[model samples]
Structure formats: structure tokens, C-alpha cells
Target: MNQSELRELLSTEGLRLLDSLPAWHSSDEIVRTIAELRKAGHSPGLVAAVLSQSKLRAKAASKFGPFAERMLFTEAGLEQATRLSVAAQHAGRFSKAGVKWVADLGCGIGADALAIAALDLNVTAVERDETTAAIAAFNLAPWHNAQVVHGDAESADLAGIDGIYLDPARRDARVRLTNPADWTPSLDFAFGLAERYPTGIKLGPGIDRDLIPDNAEAQWVSVGREVVELGLWFGTVARPGIRRAALVIGDHGTAELTAAADSEDEAAGELGQYLYEPDGSVIRARLIGDLARQLNARMLDTSIAYFSADAAVATPFATCFEIVADFALDKRSLKKELASRKIGTLEIKKRGVDIDPATFRTSLSLKGENSATLILTRVGGKRRALLAQRTTFAETSAATA
Candidate 1:
């Protein structure tokens, strides 16, 4: 939001109204709410701003949890903000390293700062966007140990800070900036901070691996099976002999796999009784070999991340599927085979293949009461389809990254 609208939303009347409104829902009648709000003697701008914030608060709940109730946010700021649970891990590193004070540069909406302050550590959060900085200040007002500064992160004063965390702005005016150099406080500047203090840089999981510094500990973190961020830690916070790591958080709890480097893959073998799909974080961390070894599994294809085993294994790092049937990659024959089995409810999974699952589903024109999963991939360097059922160890789909 712009400065004027921000002022309106922060006003006593606006905040009270926002708090009084019912939680936003997709099915909620927007026109009626706007009319009712306008008729209540609130200005049009104030009503619009508060309504927008109410919706944003609902969306922010996924990341901020209960804290979202009292927090303020900008659309872009909330989008880039770290999930509180994940941010707590980032905060723990500094705490474990005995860093009492942290400089959270480019701290969008003060997410990481909130996590840090919750640990009883002092934090200085800096942001360049005027509106976002104000929103961050509102969110952080509850933490006496936290301070918000409206200034450039590259020039933010880090004098007494024991640790530094930088999340460079990767977007501009709602458009993503793909070039690393385009990032505000550029990688050159953020990475250079490691020379002066313990530093942590949060990057997208898809960032080029070659761009990562050899000295940093690259940790790929996944929440609920979704690979979220790649955090590179340097100096005291960086763990020795841990160059690559996968941190997975799920309903079952958290699981971690770390290695000094990418582990060598086990030799590809013939199709086994079960298939295991590694979580995105594991695949991104390049520790699939390590995970496979832990599960006593081998790769289905040397080039694919899919693993095959003689028996089902229960592990949080991967999802298990019991193979029921295998078929050649022929559309007509596959359709006939599925129809013969009365298969209707379908979960399509694919790797090392070109077909889109949705299109294939439509092409099949399926109609049956029974449910089954279809896995389209390569076996022995040739296309094949496997009909399988999710085993007890699997919680849900570990979506392909």
C-alpha cells in the first residue's frame, strides 16, 4: 500500500474496524461488505485498505500462525516473509553459536526478526521499502528487544551485531528479478558481510548450485513436503563437515540428512516391489544417495531420483508406494488395462517423462469407483507405466519439484 492508505489503516478507527470484521473467506460477499463499511461513515480509501489487510491477514496465517492476528503486512512483504517455524531454526543457529545480537538486513515484515526476538536475543531489522518498513515496525512493536530501521540493508549499521542475516530483495514492483546481480544489496554485498561477522543468506531452492560459495553450509528446508528455501550459513553458524543438508518438517515431526558433499548414488537396478519418491528438499540438497542408503533402496534410473526397494520402508524423507502392476507406455493399451481393472479415482505421478498428468487423465476418459495411482516414468532406459497404491508410510503426494 502507498503512504496515504497506510496512514488510514493504522488509524484507531481503521484498526478497530479491521479487528471487528469477520475472518475473510473466498466465498464472502465483497460488494456487500464494502457497501456496509462505506455506509458506516468510513472513507472509501480507509474501507478499501482495511478490507485488503483483512484478506492479507487470512493469507498470512499460514506463515505467521497466531501472530498474524495482530501483525501488519504488505502483499509483497508477506509473500517473501519466512515461515515462523523455519525462521526459528535460522534463529537457533545464531543462538547456538553464542551470538546474542543479530542484524536482520532486508527483513521483510520482520519475520526472521520475530523468531530471533522470541529467543530472547536482540535484533535490528532493516528494510528499504517505506510501507513495508512501517508494517514491519507494527508487527515488531510487541518485542522490546527488536528494532526496525527504514533504510538500505547494504548500508544498515551493524556495529554491535554478533550475527548478520540478509534476504536480498529478489523482486521489483511485483516482477521477479532472475539475475542475481539485480538483487538489492547484491550478492556481492550480502556475501561480503561474512568477512566481518557470522552471516546467513536465504535463497530460493532453485538457485544455481554453482553460485553457492564453497565455504558456506547450504541447507535446503522443506515444510509439509514443499521445498521452501535454501539457507547458506557462514562463519561460526556454519557447521563443519556439513556442506549439504536437507531439513524436512512434517506432521510426523522434523527430519534432517546432512553430508560433507553429495553422496555417490547406488547402482540402478531392475524394478523392485516398491518405489520411493524423495521429498523436494532431499532432491534439491543432492543427498538423495544418502537417503536411499538409509532406506536400503536403489535408483530406478541412474538419471532419475525415483528409488526402488524389495520391501516398503517407513521414512519421513521419502514417500513409499507399493507397485501393483506395470505396463508399457502405450496410451490405448493403458486405457484398456485401467478400464479392465475398473479404476476411476486416480493420482498420476511422473518422472523422466513428457506427458502431462491432467491431459493424460482427460484422454483416458476414466469412470470407475475404485482408486489407484498411475506412475509414468522410465524403467531400464525405456518408458513404462506402473500402477501403484500409496503405502502406509506415505502421508500424501511428495510433488515433483
Candidate 2:
């Protein structure tokens, strides 16, 4: 974006520019470019945001520098684009259901819209902000039948839309949340939209379960093995039950749901001969019971997320690990054993331990050959540690990137 066009974009539209300067190809080049852009009228924040997004896009090899120059890559837009993995996740749902038409509401930069369109879905994308709407339009230009409309979804006429999708904007250019209440159209309002058609609501993983309407089936999704987003599905496939599903794309794995009967059942402790830790997505979905049933695993502790089952079973739901050694906590002994192993990397995964792993590793001088996962926790109310490696079955058969 040239200085003249950029100044007109910001000054005439009452738009808040976030970042818009090219990344400093070199330190001196960046200083020179910023000086020139400022002289031509560009805010530092705007310059920074634009350059940051450009850098990120460059990293991803998205050759859209000319487009970035015009758009404001605010923290919110970057976060909505990068942090929220719901678009790809919702696309996965379509891949599972074989659906082809999707209505992407509040499409922002059209990241999700593009993803779904890539999967061959006819996308009807709507955005409210002229600047953001324009960016979304540009991002989705490659997809045929991608209709980018400028309007608020809360009042937009909804007709002939097959599958509904909404991503409520929560933050502004300053990176401050505009209104907590505006995080989304009310659930009541969303339900109204879903009542007319199948819908998916993209939400933060931290959203409370109580906020989820009973009419919708909520599923937490992880992409590339990380639990990154949560979604609530409303319509024909929506279940009136709490469920958790793990999607390991390119593999055939059963989607598991928590039975009503099981939901009412209290969790119990079952520290047995083996231990299983459900993938983050499974845990987020609250499908522990289904996972246990799938693997014949039982809970190791009522309050902990660990699961245990004796029989050998291979499921994408979790990584099964055989406990080879369990010992009491003794810093001296641990340091001695770990040092003797010549361990160089100490990967500490702890539960119920008050010690900081970094300090602990440093204190123990854990920098040699003992590069393994060290699990520290309280079992039977006693502080202890477990040394383990990926089980052969898990190492070979587990779903991992």
C-alpha cells in the first residue's frame, strides 16, 4: 500500500489502522522505510502491525504483501486468523459430514471461509467492517461462488443458507476487547440462527460449559495434535449429550460421546498397572468415559486427568504408556540417576507438584544424556515421580504428527 492510499484509507474511513509497514528486510532498511512511511504519514503502531503480519505471512509463504499493505493486521485480526483454529476444524467437520455449502458469518479476513471453500464448499461469507470485509474478500478471491457481503449477521437476512458458521469479533485494533458482551451474539440469538439451519459456533477453548446451550452438541477440536479451539454444533447432528471427539485427520477413528448415564456417573480413582493420558482434545471435550470404554481404561485419580487400563489397546484417543518405574521424590537420588544416564534434555510434566521444573532441572544439573519425560505428581497423597518413554505400541500405532 502506498503512503497516499494508506493515508486515505485511514483518514477517510474513520478506520483504526493497526500495522502496515513492510517488514524490515534488514535493520537499517527497516529504519529507513519507517522514516519514509512516517514522513508520508503512518502511525508507528500501524507500521508495526502491518510489518508483523507481513513477517508472519512471509513465514507461511503467503505472497500477499500488496494486500497486507492495505489491511490493518491488528492483534485481534492476527489472533482471530492464527490463534482460532476453528475454520480448519469446521472444515474437518464438513469433511466428515460430506457437506458442501457453508455460511461463514463475521468472516473477518475470510481465513475460515477460504479453508471451507478449499474443501469445495460454496461459501456465503458476511463481514461488517469495510476494511476487514475488504481483506476477507481479497483473501477468498480464488474461490468461485464466494459471496462476500458487508452487513452485521445479527440482523442480516438469513435465507437459503445450508450450513451456518459464526465467529464473533471480540477485540479491536488497540487489542482491548470492545465489549465482553459483544464477544458473541447472545447464545439465545445464536440459537435463533441455528433454529433455521445447521450451525457451528466458533468459541475460545476457555469458554464455560454452562454457557453452551443444552440444544447444541459441543466438541473441542485440536489441529495437528494441539487442542486449540472449541465448537458447538446445532441442528440435525446436534446431540443432547456431552461428548468429546478426537479428529486425527487422514485416519479412520470413531467419534466418541459421553453417554447420559456416564455423564451422571462420578469419576473414580483407579491407579492400576498402567497409565493413559487422553489427548488434550479428548480431555477438553470432556469424553473421559468414552475414552475409557474405547481403551478399557479407568481413571487413575478422580481429580487428575490420567487414565489406566491393564490390557494392551491402541486408540487415537490417547497415548498409552507402561509405567516402568515409580519412585519417591528425592532430589539427590533423581539427580544422581539422571546424571548417570547422561541425560541432556529433561522434559518435566508434573501434576500436584509445587516445584518449578525449570528451576528443578537447573538445580539437578540435568543437562547431559538423560533426555526423557519426567512426570512428577502426588499418588496416594505422596509426592513421587515416574520415569517413562513412549510404549512400543504408542510409538508405532499412535496418531501423531
Candidate 3:
């Protein structure tokens, strides 16, 4: 949004209209609403700005929760905003470290600052973009302790700051910048701050391992099925002796696995009744061996992450599937096996394989009413397909012991 649209959206009338509008749904409804607003004598700019905000608010709900209703958003700001649940953890870290004040650098739309302030801590939310700063200021207005700084994050005055949180903008013109040097505020600047104070840096899950500072605690977090962010903590906030951690937040509840460094991989062993696919965070943190040991499971292959165990152990770090049948890794065999079972619903998963699940699904021509998960992988240097059924929470609990 430009300055003109921003000005209109920030106006008293504009905000009132935005809150008064019906919850946004389809684009077809936009046409009629636009016409109605135009007939009501609202300027084209105001109508466009409010409608856009309404639409953005709908999309922002996934990340911001109910706060999206009262908050203003820029498309890019909303895209980069941290989920409120994750932000709460960031705040809890600073609080647990006994840090009284936090400087949330690169505070897009003030998501982190909101959480920090909600914890009753003094927070300085700094944003380089003027429009985003204004939106953040508005979103954080509910908190008396939160303040927004419209300036360069690197230049933000940190006079009384007890700790700092940095989330550098890793995108330019909506394009992802893989190189840390290209990121605004730069990873170097973030690492430099870590040396002086309790610092927390948020980066993409797939960041190069070499870029991670050896002394900092690198924690990879997954919410539901996807790995979301890698948080690097330093100084007092960094837990002692813990250099790597995998935090899993999912349907089973929150579970964490931590280690000093990457644990040695367990020896590849025979397939058991249960197969465990480690969560992405566990895989990225390279804590598979540690998790496997906890579950009494072993790697099914040296290079593959899949694990096999005798018991149906329930753990948040991985999804457990009961292996039903195995077949030679070939389409003809799979077709015949699938046909015999009358399998219609196929949840195809793969590791160390070249097949594309979607395109391969078409090849199988599944049409049965039943559902099953087909794991295409390697076992003992041989390609094979394993048909498995997902263990429900109840089944997993029953098998746990």
C-alpha cells in the first residue's frame, strides 16, 4: 500500500468502515461492495484501501489470530509476520532469561513486539519501512509498554535494552534472498549483537549449517507438519551445553529433543512393525539418532531418515505408521498390489527417491474407496515400497509402553 492508501486507512472514518464491513469472503462480493462504497460517496482510494485491508485481514488470521481483526496490514508485512504462537515462545525466552527489556529489530507489523509487550516487558519494535512501522504502531497501541521505532533496525538506539531479537528481511521485491549478506540488517549484524547481549535471531528453516554460529543454540521448530523457523539464541538466553534442539508443536502437544551437537546415527537394522518418519525439525537439527534412541528405533537405511522399531511407541518427534506389506520397488508390482487391496485413496510419501508423488499417483490410477500411505524408499541398498496405515492418537497411546 502507498502513502495515499495508508493515510486513508489510518483515518478515523476509514478504520471505522473497515471494522463495520462484513467478513470478507469471495472476490465476486468485492464487486458489489466496491460499487456500494463508491455510491456512498467514499473516495476510490479509501474504498480500495479498506477492501484490500479486509481481504488482508482475512489472510492474516492464520498468523495473527484474532488480533488480525483490529490490526492493519501490508501484504508483505503480513507475509513476513511471525505466527503469534511462535512469537509467544520468543517472548517467553527473554522473560525466562530475566531480560527486562527487548529490542525487536525488524519488527514487521509488530507481531513479536506484541507478544513481548503482552508478557508485560518493555519492548522497542523497530521497522525500516515507514508504512509497516505505522501499522505496527497501531497494532501495538493496546500495550502501554510497547513502542514502535520508525528507522533502520541496525541504527535503533539500544540504551536500556537487556536483550535483542532480530528477524532480518530475507526478501526483496517478494523474491527470497538466499544469501545472508543480501538480507536487510544482515546476519553479520545479528551475530555481532549476540556477542554483547542475550540475542535471539530467527532465520529460515533451511539455512546453511555453515552459516550458524558454533557457540549459539540453534533450535529448529515445527508447527503441525511443516518446519517453520530456526531460532538462534546466544549469551544468557542460550541454554548451557545445548547447541542443537528440535521443538515440535503439533496435535500430540509440544515435545522437544536437545543435544550438544549432532548425535551419531544409529546402525541400520531390519524393518519392524512400526515405521517412524521424523519431523522436519528433527531432521534439520540432525537429531534423528537422539530421537531414534529415545524411541528404541533404528535407522532403516544409513542415508535414509526412516526408522523402524518393534513397538508402536508414541512420540511427538515423528509420525508412526504400522507397516502392512512390502513389495519390490516397481510400478507394475505396486499396481498389482494396490489393485488387490482395492486401494483408492493413496497418500504417497517418499525419501531418497526420484518419483514425483502427484505424477506417480496418476500412473497408479487409484480408484478404490480405501486409503493407505505408501512409503517409497530404500531398504538395505534395495529399492522397495512399503504400504502402511497411520496410527491414530488412541492407537499410538495404546501401543506406548
Query: Per-residue CA lDDT of candidate 2, range 283-357, in tens?
Result: 776666667766666665556667666665766667666665677888999888788777778777777779898
lDDT of residue 46 for candidate 1: 94
**Model 2 per-residue lDDT at 369:** 51
Provide the clash count, candidate 1. Answer: 0
Could you estimate the TM-score for every candidate? 0.96, 0.74, 0.97
Tens-digit lDDT string for candidate 1 (1-401): 89999999999998999999898998999999999988989999999999999999999999988889888888888888999989999999999999999999999899999999999999999999888889889988989999999999988887888899999888888888889899987988988998789999999999999999999999999999999999999999999899999999989888899999988887798998889999999999999998888878889898999999887767889988989999999999989998998988899999999999999999997888899999999988999999999887433333211
> CA lDDT of 45 in candidate 2?
60
lDDT of 1 at 270: 90
In terms of lDDT, the poorest run of 10 residues in model 2 is 257-266
For candidate 2, report its TM-score: 0.74
RMSD (Cα, Å) of candidate 1? 3.1
Model 3 residue 356 CA deviation (Å) reads 1.0
- TM-score-better candidate, 2 vs 3: 3
For residues 117-173, what per-residue lDDT tens digits would candidate 3 score against the true structure? Answer: 999999999999998999999999999999999999888999999999999999998
How far in Å is the alpha carbon of 111 misplaced in model 1?
A: 0.5
The CA lDDT at 183 in model 1 is 98
In each prediction, how many residue pairs overlap at the backbone (N, C-alpha, C within less than 3 A)?
0, 15, 1
